[model samples]
Every structure is written in C-alpha cells, then in structure tokens.
Target chain A: MRNLIWIGFWGLFVLHQDFWYWNDATLCFGFLPIGLAWHVGFSLACSLFWMAAMKFAWPEEIEAWAAESTER
Target chain B: MEYLSFYIVVGYLALLIVLGLVSKFYSRGTSADFFVVSRTVGPVLLLLSVFGTTMTGFALVGSTGKAYTSGIGVYGLMASWAGLMHSVVFFIVGIRLWAIGKKYGYLTQCEFFRERFASPALAYLLFVILVLLVIPYLLVGVISAGKFLQGATIGMFPDLFGLPPLVLPDGTERQHPLHGSIPPEWGGLLICLVVLFYVFVGGLRGAVWANAFQTVVFMVCGVLAFYLISQRLGGFARATEMVAISPFASNRLVREGNMTQLYFLSYGLIPLSVGMFPHLFQHWLTARSAKSFRLTVIGHPVFVMIVWLPCILIGVWGAAYLGPLATGQNPNMILGRMVKELVDSQILSGLVTAGVLAAIMSSLDSQFVCLGTMFTSDIVLRLSRRTYSDEQKIMLGRIFIVAVVAVTYGLSLLLKDVALVFDLGIWCFSGFAGLFPIVFAALYWRRTTKAGAIAATLAVAVSWSILFYRDMLSDKPPGSDELTLFGVLPVTAIFLLSVLAIVVVSLITSPPSANTLRKFFPDERLSRR
Candidate 1:
C-alpha cells in the first residue's frame, strides 16, 4: 500500500510537468497564463504529497535510530 | 531614500555580527562544537538554515533578471523541480547520512567516503574535486552581493572617494544615474570582510542562527516587495493584463526560442546536486537527530514557492513596465531598479535592500564555514596523522577560511561584466550534479567500490572542464545557446558518463569487503536479496 501511494504521487507529479503543454498560451481565469497557473497548482499539490510521504513512507528504523540517539 | 537604504543595509550587517558573537558563548571550545554545533540544532533552525543556504542570491536577483529575458519558464525550469526534488533528496540522502554520521562521529563528506571505501587516497582525491566545485559557487555568492549592493545604493556616492568619472573611448566623461554609486569590486570586498568576520567568530552555530534570522528578514520583505510592486503596477490583475497584451506575452506562456523540451527536462537533474554539496553535508551533520530533517523535507517546497513565485512574477511584469533594457546594461540590476521605481518610501526600500542582502549573506556564511571545516578536517588533520588540540583545529580552520575568502574576493574583482547570475550559477550546479551519481551509489549500492568512485569523480572533472571550455570559446552566452547532445543537456551527458564509469569500473574491480559492506548497510543486504 505504501509503495502504491508513492508510485501514484510520483506518477502524477512527473506527468504534470507540462512540457508537452507548453504551447497553450490561453490565460486562466482571464489573467494568469495557463502554463504558469498549472505549475502554481502543481506546487500546492506537491506540498500535500510530500506531507503524505512523511506520514506513511518515512523509514521506521530512522525513527528508532533518532530515539536511541536522544537517550544517549 | 537611497541613503536610508544604504544605512539600513549597514545596520543589518551589524546585527549579523552581533549574532555571530552571541553564538560564541555556546561554543564548548571543541572542534566538533565549532564545526557541527555539537550536533544539537533543533528542527526549526535546521529547516531555516538549510533552506536559507540553498536559496542564495540566485533565487532573488538572478531569477528576476532571468524572467525579464526568458519569461515565466524560469520557475518551471528551476524552482518547481527544486521544490519537489530537493525534499526528496533530504529524505533519501540527508536522513541516511545523518544516521551514519552520528553513529560514526563523522564531520565531513570526505570522512564518510574514506571509511565507506576504506581508502585514504580516495578521500584526498574527492577533497580536491569537491573544493574545486565549491570555489565557483562561492564566487557566485560574492559576485551577486557586489552587484546587489551596487544597484541598491545607486547615486548614494557622488564622487566615489573623490575619483574622477570614467572617460569613454570618445574622450567624453560617462554619466551614470548616481555619479558615485559603489562599484562591484568595492561592494564585493565589503561583503567578504563582513562575512569573514562572522564566520571567524561564530562557526556553524553562528551561521545557523544568522540563517534563521536572515531567512525571516528576506521572506517577509520579499512578500512585501512583491505586494508593493504589484500594487504599483495597478494591482495583480492589471499587471497580468499588461503582460498578456505585451509583445512578450508569448514568452509568458510558452518558452519561445532556445528553450527546447529536452533542455527543459534535463534541468530536473540540477537539484539532485544537493546530495553532494559539502555545505549541505555539513548542515546535515548538524541535525540534533535523524528526525530533525522531517520539517526541512516537508516544508522546503513551500519555502521555495514563497521566495521564487514573487521574483518570477516581478521579472515577468518588468517586461511590460520597464520595456527593453539598454545594450550592455546588467539585467541583474532589474530587480533593484523595479524596487526603486515602485516603492515611494525610503525606509521600506531600505528594508527591502537589507532583505536582498540577507538572502545573499545567509548562503555566504555557510559556504565560508563549510570550506573551513573541510580543509581542517579532510586535509590538514587527516594528512598530518596526529591528534591536535581543539584550539589548534579551530585556528587552522580560521586561517584556511581567511585564505579562501581572499582568493574568491580577488577573483571577483578580476571578473568584469561576467555572465548573468543565473547562467554562471547553473554551470556551477551542473558540475556538482555530475558528481551526484558517485555519492548516491556509495550510499545505496553495496557493490560500489573505491576504484569506481575514483573513476566517476575523474569523469565529472574532465567532462565539466571540457564543456566549460567549450562554453567559454563560443560567442553564445553560457546558457543562451540551445546546445544538446543526443537531445539532452550537457549535464545529462556528464552524468551518464559518471554512472557508466562507476558501474563498469566496480564490476571489473574487486567489490568492497563484506565487513565494510555490513558496517555501512547491515540490515539492507537481506532486503536487497
């Protein structure tokens, strides 16, 4: 399940890069350019994805290691 | 207003010096305390210091100028990729390194490589390559500080210490907006001296505290500068409207001309350079615990957004408002010019100027301290093969730090109207990125050998030198030409060569001993099978 989540997040993340969509000059909401707007939204999504990764995919041993170090 | 801004910048420098002195109290008079802050930095300070060091002047002054010339694509090419990838590196490379560092009492990257490969000669080779890669990066910081100071204090000096105006080839005295604005040479020298003083006194702990404070100053002032500039351009909507109808509108949406798809995609590799940065390695070792990196990994993207979004927008907006800059004018001065034109209050502009300097100096202090640590730990002490007192180690580091600052400052003075800040910085990042494969493999792959690591390092050095020389010879600007090999960036070529050298050489050579492998990755071997 954790592997699936990482795959899904990275999949969407890489796809949204929008290199192929660079030709679109249409303005979004009548002001922001579509390319720039796409990235703005994507950046926000990345923040959530990264937070999720921290919650689920973080290495358990690292947590244990940190706990051990502090006790010393 | 100009004088006020100069005074504010001076005051900011004084504040940083005080912060440096305060950190001295925390020093335990040990090399470890001086180099890695006794390994006791909390999450918040670590997050701020790491983020602050990564941003540099390129995020502010360079990005604005890049946006003016290239368009909004600058954000996608650099920032967005960095936002996601930098965090990924922190999670993968940073935490693991911290775990290993703490367990082994390691203080520098060379020490880790030496132990992992069990080869002292390899450590010496890596040290030379790493220092060579770092000096150009240090030069970038110094050059940008000089440029920013000169631009912010324009017209504040009329006579330039009573020196006459420069005469043009036509025998006419040249006229500038302010007669005696500080030149890049003098401005760069002043910044070097100030940074040297703090790093001399405070060490890594001083750099961390200063980074946290400077991070706040730059972020708050950056946001304010963004808001004020947009408001002066008749609000965000009006500014967008202006850019939408301008001749450069196409540049805003699509990367028009020279920004090819392959080239754009290759920039994704650039942020991976963080894994190999000596300064970042130093910062990673300073973490109080492995868990301290959690905040930095999660929060880095948001910080990148906050800082980069404004600079990119301001640059895009400059297209319509400022129009085309004159020939031979420094595009790096665009951000400074926009602030002067938009802000009416002297105190506000003064604060903003200090904010820009804050961003530049935050990175400068860390680089200075990191180099000092590397020389003392990796070269001097390692080669001498004798134990030294804590005072001797600290004094040796300080002497090397002073030497580095003097050399970099002297180089900055010799440079006249060099490449744009973004262009010079990208080349430096490319060299480090090319070396990333070696470090990544050493940490993850048990088969990686000392021979392979040496081969990869040499490949990066040779390819970087050849590509850099080629770039210098061409009439095209460093990054302006749409040059690609097999439809990928020069960095991609260099990175591939490095990987090949490492993989093939390690296969032909004897693998690392089982004991060495167990020590580095005791639990991971079973999982790999």
Candidate 2:
C-alpha cells in the first residue's frame, strides 16, 4: 500500500508535466482548452491520491506517541 | 445604483467587525487564546483559514491580470503546481509541525526554531527576514483591494471624484468614470482599518472565522462573475471560440514555442513557499488534532482549482473582450473592469465588489494577526525577559499589530504606481520558497545542526536579495520574459543553493547533541514512552 501510494505521488508529478499538450489548443467540453482540461483532471487526481495517502500512509505511530507524551 | 457596490462593501466590513466582537466574547483573554485560539480549532475552520490565507487578492485580481497578458498558460504555471504541491506540503510538513507545536505550545515559527536548534541568533535572523518578506506580500493584498474597489465603483461618485476624459485611438473621447468614486488610497485605507479592527478585537480566532466566511463569498461570487461575463461576451463556448480565432488574443490559447518546459516546471518550486509562510505555520498549529489536517490536505487542491479556474478563465477572456489595455494601466484592475463593463446589475456588481474585498481582507486579517503574534511572542517577550501578564501581552500584540498595519498601508499608498501584483507576489513567494530547505531540514534531518540551519537561512536571504535587486530594482530591470537566469526561474537556483548550503554545512559541522536528536527524531523515545 505504501509503495503504491509513493508510485501514485511520483506518477502525478510526471503526468503534471504534460509536454504533449503544450501546443494542443483544441477545446475540450466545448470551451475548456485542452491544456486547461488536462489540469482539471490533474487537480482531481491529486485530491484522490492525497485521500488514499491519508488512509494508508498516515504516520499513525508518530501521532500516537505525541498523544502518549501529553498524557505522561 | 452608482454607490450600490460601495454600500455593499461597507456592509461586508460591518459584518466582519461583528464577527470579531462576537469572537471576543468567547475568547478566554489568555495570550494562548489570542495567538493560537488555544489550539482547539476544528477541521473545517482550519481548512478554510489556511485555504483563505493562501488565496488572497493574488489569486483573484493578480491572476486575472497575469492571465490577460500571459494567456491560458498562467493556470499551468502556478495554479496546477500549487494545487498539487500545497497538498503535499500540508500532509507531510504541516502534520508534523502541528504535533510538535501542540506538544510545546508554540505560537510562532520562530518560537519553534528557537527551541529546536537552541540558537536565539538564528531565530532572530529568521524573524527579521520573515517580517521583511511579509510586508510586500501584505502590499499585494492591499493594492489589489484598493484597485478592485476603484475600478468597480468608477463613476459612482463622478461629481466628487471625476477625472478628465480619455482620447481613444479612433479620435473619440471616453469619459473617465472613476472620477467621482473611491480612490485607491481610500480603498486601501478602509481595508487596512477594517482588518485592524477585527484582528485587534478577536486576534487569530476572529481572523479564522472571517476567513471561512470570506472564502465562501469569494468562491460563489467568482463563479457568478465567470458565468455572467461569459454570457455578456456570448455563451461560454462562443466566448472562448472568439478568442481562439481573434487576432488580438488567439495566441493566448496556446503555449507552443513561448513558455519553456523548464520554466513551467520551475513553478513547482514556487508553491514550496507555503512550507515557509509564517502565517500558514501559525494556522497549522491551530488544529485541534493531527487528524484535523486530513481534510485540509485532501481538500486543498480541489479548493484551489475551484477558485483559480474562474479567475484564470476570466483573465484569458479579458484579452478578447476588452481588447488591448492602455499604457500605464495596471493589469490587476482587468478583473474589475470586465465586471463593471459586462455585468450590469447594480446588486450583482455590489456582490462582486464585496467578494473581491472578502478575498483581500481575509488574507490581510490573518497576516496582521500573525505578525502581531510574532512580534509579541518571538521578539518582545523573548527580548524583554519579563514575565508579563496575559492582558499585557495581548495589549502589546495589539499595539504591534497597529504599527505593522500602519507601515504596510503607508507603503501601499507610495507604491501605487509601481506595484505589479502578480510579479511582486511571485518575487515574494520565491524568497519564501528559498527558505523551505531550512524548515524541512529542521523537521526531518536528524544530523542538521544549528550552524547548518543558520547558513542555509543566510544563503537563501543573500541570494534572494541579490537576484531581486538585479531583476526588479535595478535601473534597467529586465522585462518579464527576460527575468529568468539561463531560461529557468530564479526560485529554482535559490532553492538549490539553500539546499546545497545546508547539506554541505551539516556534513562538515559537528552534529547536534544526542538529547536534541532524540527529542526531534523521537522513534526510540516513542517506543520507550
């Protein structure tokens, strides 16, 4: 799960570069520019990736330790 | 109808004041309550305040103007990069900072630094550098608010504030309608006073409450403005199609051969500035639990897209509808001008004005409160060596807030002519980005020494200063397209140098004491505890 999360993180970073779309001015969804449309998808992907990260890769032990320290 | 926008803006200000007074009723009057809301902020308010502070007038006004000149590529340059990078920072850096801050009751970044490295000198240096950088940032919001109001309310008070008519290229004279309305200085002053009142009365609590309210207002109004303007130009599809074919702005729809791939990539470094923003650091500490960051980390990117898409699109469309801007025109006013020209309902116009004010003031209130917190906790309390009472500390903080507000407002008035909101804001963010290496090292690197931290801080400050002076302040400052070094943004170079300095210095210098390492690294200690 952690490795998958890491892969997703880098994948998003690589996909965000979108060099092929730089010159593609074709409109998507009637009005959205191809480049702009690409990013709207990128933004949604980021949200989902982060949600998965919180569920799988969150530093639970560290947080538990901090809470324990407060109690002590 | 002419003064309708102005009246709505005034009402919005009144609402903020009422929110502040109401927050004061709940405040415990302790220094902790005033500074970090006693570290009890829930997830929703935390998300809104952090998101609101990040957006500012730069997102709404400056972005539209930048999009006008640069085209649709503006969205790719900053918005998309910010949408992704900010969430990464919040999840990784923010959660840790919140945990440590809650453990130690840290109210400001410098306070954490002071304890982490056991170096007051480094903390003081960072405090000075942060204040210097933040003033320009505050100026961006102030200048944008003033310009937005001035452009929105033009001709509303024509008898009182009318200017001479402008001669067009076609030999026709157009009346300067802004003649009898609120001037930029007055607009800036009103915003400054209103922010000062709320921050003075309610402190960080008031700022956060108002930020949540303001965030909702701007997002709704932003979409409304986008929809109304698209309709005014034609339908959304037709509006964009016209620009795609028009001689004046067809080039804006594409980025081929103009913006370099390296340059577009360098913008990824700019949003790293949020990692080092003192205001954001303070906001992070206000979370009630480490899990409180979950919503912020997940929701931030979508919120950024929601706010930025409209502003960026409106800006791109401006080039087609408004044609070319006249000489000496501030691009920051393009968003306002489009609304005034196209969106004709007085009530709708007033709503838009209030929305812009909400975005601008939401940021200003937090920054004012943050600076005051820094001054009181990091500087005055540390230097004076006196155990002052809670009331006295709060009073001192309010006084410093007033002083900082005064200085920022005065500078905003003087720079009305020179301020380019987008460019100036980018430069400020670059400086902050350059400082991110220090903070990251502080949190994650067990071997990072106080000396390395100081060296990295100095390296970022010195490099940022030299680049800014050469590129922006020099008598022959480079044009926008020419500001890069070897075709890459200066932020990339500055960030690299700071990272290099920290790594080399840390390896060469004596490592931190075992006790210091244990406290920060804490895995062993965690198991023992």
Candidate 3:
C-alpha cells in the first residue's frame, strides 16, 4: 500500500508537469491562465500527497531513534 | 516616503541586533551551542528558518522582476517546482541526514562525506566546490539588498554626494535619478554588517531566531504589497483581466516562442539542490528530534504558495500596467517601484520595505553562520592533528564569518551590474543540483564508493565551469533562453553526467567496506550482523 501511494504521488507529479496546457488559452475563474491554474491545483494536491507520505511512508526506525534520543 | 522607508529599515536592523545580543543568553559558551544551538531547535523555528533560508532575495525581488518580463512562466519554472520538491527533500533527505548527524555528531556536509567515504581528501574537494558555488548564492542576496535599498530610498539624498551625471560620448545625458540616494554599495555594506553582527554575536541560534521573526514579517507584508498593488491597478480580477487582454496575453499564460517543454521540466531538478546545501545540512542537524521535521515537510509547500502567489501575480500585472521596462533599467527594482507608486501611505511603504529587507537578511544570516561553521569544523578541526579548545573553535568560526562577509560584499560592490539576481541564482542552484546525485547515493546506496564520490564531484565541477564560462562569454540579456542541449537545461546534462559517473565508477571500484555500510545503514538487518 505504501509503495502504491509513493508511485501514485510520483505519477501525479509527472502528469501535472507534461505541459499539456502550453497551448491552452482558457482562463480559470476569469483571472488565472489555464496553465497556471492547473499548477495551483497541482500545488495543493502535492501538499496532500506529502501529508499522506508523512503518515504512511515515514521511516519507522527513524521515529524510534528520535524517541530513544529524546528519552535519554 | 523615501525617508520613512529608510528609517523603517534602520529600525529593523536595530531590532535584529537586539535579537542577536539577546541570543547570547541561551549560549552555554561552547562551540556546540554556538554552531548548532546544541541541537535543541523545535519544529516551528526549524520550519521558519529552513523556509526563510530557501526563499532568499531571489523569491521576492528576482521572481517579481522575471515575471514582469517573462510572464507567469516564471512561477512554473521555479516557485511551483520548489513548492513540491523542497518538501520532498525535507522528507527523503532531511530526516535521514538529521538522524545521521545526531548519531555521529557531524557538523557540516563535508564532515559527513569525509567519514562516509573514508577519504579526508574528498572532504577538502567537496568544501572548495561547495564554497565556490555558495559565494555566488551569497552574492545574490547582497546584490538584491543593495538594489532594493537604492530603489526604496530614491530621491532621499538628491545631489548630496555631488556626483556629476554620467553622459555618453554622443552628448546624451544619462538618466541618473537614484545616484543621490543610499547607493547599492553603501546599502549592501550596511546589510552585510548587520547580518555579520548577529551571526557573530549569537551564531546559529541568533540566525534561526531572526529567520522566524523575519519570515512572519515578509509573508504578511508581501501579501499586503500584493493587495495594494492590485487594488491600485483596479481590483485583483480587473488587474488580471487587463493582463489577459493585453497583446502579450499569451506570454502571461504559456512560455511563448522557442521555449521547449524539456527546459521547463528540467527546472524541477534544481530544487533538489536543497539536499546538498551545507547551510540546510546545518539546519537539519539542529532539529531537537526527527519529529521536528514533520512540520517542516507538511507545511513548507503551503507556505511557499502563500509567499510566491502574490509576487508572481504582481509581476504578471506589471506587464500590462507598468508597460515595457525602461531599457537598461534593472527589473529587480520593479517590486520596490510598485510599492512606491501604488501604496499611498508613507508608513505602509516603509513597513513593506522593511519586510523585503527582512527576507533578504534572514537568508544572509544563515549562509554566514553555515560558512563559518564549515570552515571551523571541516577544515581547522579535521585537518589539524592537534586538539583545540572550544574557545579556539569559536574564534575560528567568528573569524571565517567575517572573512566570508567581506569577500561577498566586496564582490557585490565590484560587480554591481554583473548579472540579474535570478540569472546568477539559477546558475548557483544548478551547480548544487549537479552534486545532488552523489548525496542521494551516499544516503541510500551502500555500494557508493569513495572513488565514485570523487568522480561525481569532478564531473559536476568540470561541466559547471565550462557552462559558466560560456554564459559569461555570451552575455545574454536577462530572461533570454539559456544555452541548452536538446532543449533541456544545462543542469540536466550536468546532473545526468554526475549520476552516470557515480554509478559507473562505484561499480568498477571496490565497494565501501562492511564496517562503513554498517555505520550508515544501521537499520538494515544484515548490516547489524
């Protein structure tokens, strides 16, 4: 499950970055150009993807080491 | 208004001095306390300092200027890429480095490479390359501070210096408007001295504390500046509409004409340089625990969005409102000019100028302290066979800090019109990114050999030097297409070559000894055996 999540996260990065919107002329919400608006959404999605990584993909042993060090 | 802004900047500097002096109370009078705050920094301070250090003057002044010229593609090239990749670095590289640093009591990036590769010479090689790259990065901050101050205090000291206006041989008088104000040289010197005083007084603790305070000031004032500028050109919607309807509207949306898809994608690699930054290594080690990294990783992206969104939008708006930037005028002055023109209140403008300077100084202090720490720990202590007292260590660090500040400030003055802040910054970051593959391999791949690390460093150095020379010779204007190979950034070529060198050399050479593998990869069950 964790590996799948990591793969999904990377996939999102590659997909968002493919430059598909390079020729698009549409503006989003009457202000941002379509390409930039896509990135703003992509940025928000990346934040969540990382949050999931923190919860699921964080190295457990590092946490254990940190805990032990603080206890000392 | 210019007088008011100058006073506000003075007040901000005074406040930083106070913070620096007060930080001494927390110092236990040891080199460890001075260098890394005895590794006791909490999550909030760590997040702020790390973010502040990464932002630099490039984010505020350079991004706005580039966006003014190149349009919204500036965000795609850097800010958006940084927003994601910076957090990834914090998670993958930062946490592991913190663990190793605490375990081994490593003080600098070179110290880690030295012990891991078991080659003292590798440490020296890495130090020289890192310092060479970092000095230009330091210069970016200094030059931007000088330029911003010169722009902010325009007309404040008109004709006071009595310097005659420059004239061309063709008999045209050069427009020398800001010549009478605090020149970039003097303003740059003032910023250097203030940053040096703080880092010299309280060391890393003072730097981290100042970063936290300055980060808050800049972010708040940055948003205010954005709002005021947009309101001045009509509301946000109307301002953007004006930009959208302009003939250059396509530039506002996409990278127009001759910009390749690959070149834009290659910028994603640049933020990975954060993994190899010596200052960031020092910052990572200061974490009280690995848990301190959690907040940094989770919140950094959002924080990046908050700071960058405003600056990027304002720059795009400047395309339509400000019109073509005057020929030979520095684009870095655009943000200051926008604040001066749009904001009515002198007090507000002063506050905003103070905020911008705060952002610049926050990064400057960290770089100063990190350079000093590396010099004392990596060079003086490691190379010397004799033991030194803590007082000696502290003294060496202070002396090196002063030396680095002097060198960088001198270069800033000498090369006042050398390059735009963004252009020079991209080159510096690219050099560091070229080195990132080695650091990544060192942490994750136990087979990484000492020879492999040496080869990777050499590959980056040779490639980066050639490209830098070519860039200097070409003397292309800012926002022009950088010399690229197959439409990809020069960094892509350097990074690929570096990784290839590391992998192929490590495969041919003897792998690291079992003892070394056991030490770095302590969690591996076989390594424990």
Tell me the lDDT of candidate 1.
Answer: 0.83
**In terms of docking quality, how is candidate 2 classified?**
medium
lDDT of 2 by residue, B1-529 (tens): 6667678878888999999999999999998888899888998999998999998777888789888888888887888899999998997789888888887678899988888898999999999999988998899888878877787777777677778888999999988756766899988998898889888999999899999999999998889999899999888899899889888888888776558888899889999999999999999988888888999989998999998899989998998888898986877778878887898778778888888889888888888989999998988888896799999999999999999999999998889878454368788899999999998999989888899999999999899989888777777634444478887899998999999999999999999887776666657576566
* lDDT per residue as tens, model 3, B1-529: 4477678778888999999999988788899888999999999999999999888866777778888877777777887788888888888889989988887788999988998999988999999999988888888888878877877776677666434678989998875776666888988999999999988989999999999989998898889899888788888778888887788543665665525577788889999999988998999999998888988988888888888888888888877777777788877777877876777667777877788888889888989999999888887887789998999899999999999999999888888887644477878889999999999999999889999999999999999888877775657768865677778888998999999999999999999987788777747633355
Best by TM-score: 2
Model 2 pairs whose backbones collide: B155-B177, B157-B180, B161-B179, B161-B180, B162-B179, B162-B180, B163-B179
From the highest lDDT down, the ranking of the candidates is: 2, 3, 1
DockQ of each: 0.46, 0.64, 0.48
Candidate 3 residues lying further than 4 Å off, grouped into runs, are A66-72, B159-162, B165-175, B256-258, B420-422, B474-481, B525-529
TM-score of 2: 0.95
Best candidate, DockQ: 2
The CA lDDT of each predicted structure is 0.83, 0.86, 0.84
lDDT of 2 by residue, A1-72 (tens): 878887888889989999889998999989999988999889988998899899989888657655655432
Q: Give the TM-score of chain A, superposed on the true chain A, for all candidates in the order listed.
A: 0.70, 0.86, 0.76
How many steric overlaps are in each model, in order?
1, 7, 0
- Candidate 2 at B322: error in angstroms? 2.5
Q: What is the lDDT of residue B281 in candidate 1?
A: 94
| Candidate 1 lDDT, B34-62, residue by residue in tens | 89999999899999999999988778888
Error of 3 at B520 (Å): 0.2
Question: For each of the candidates, what fraction of the native contacts does it recover?
Answer: 0.44, 0.60, 0.46
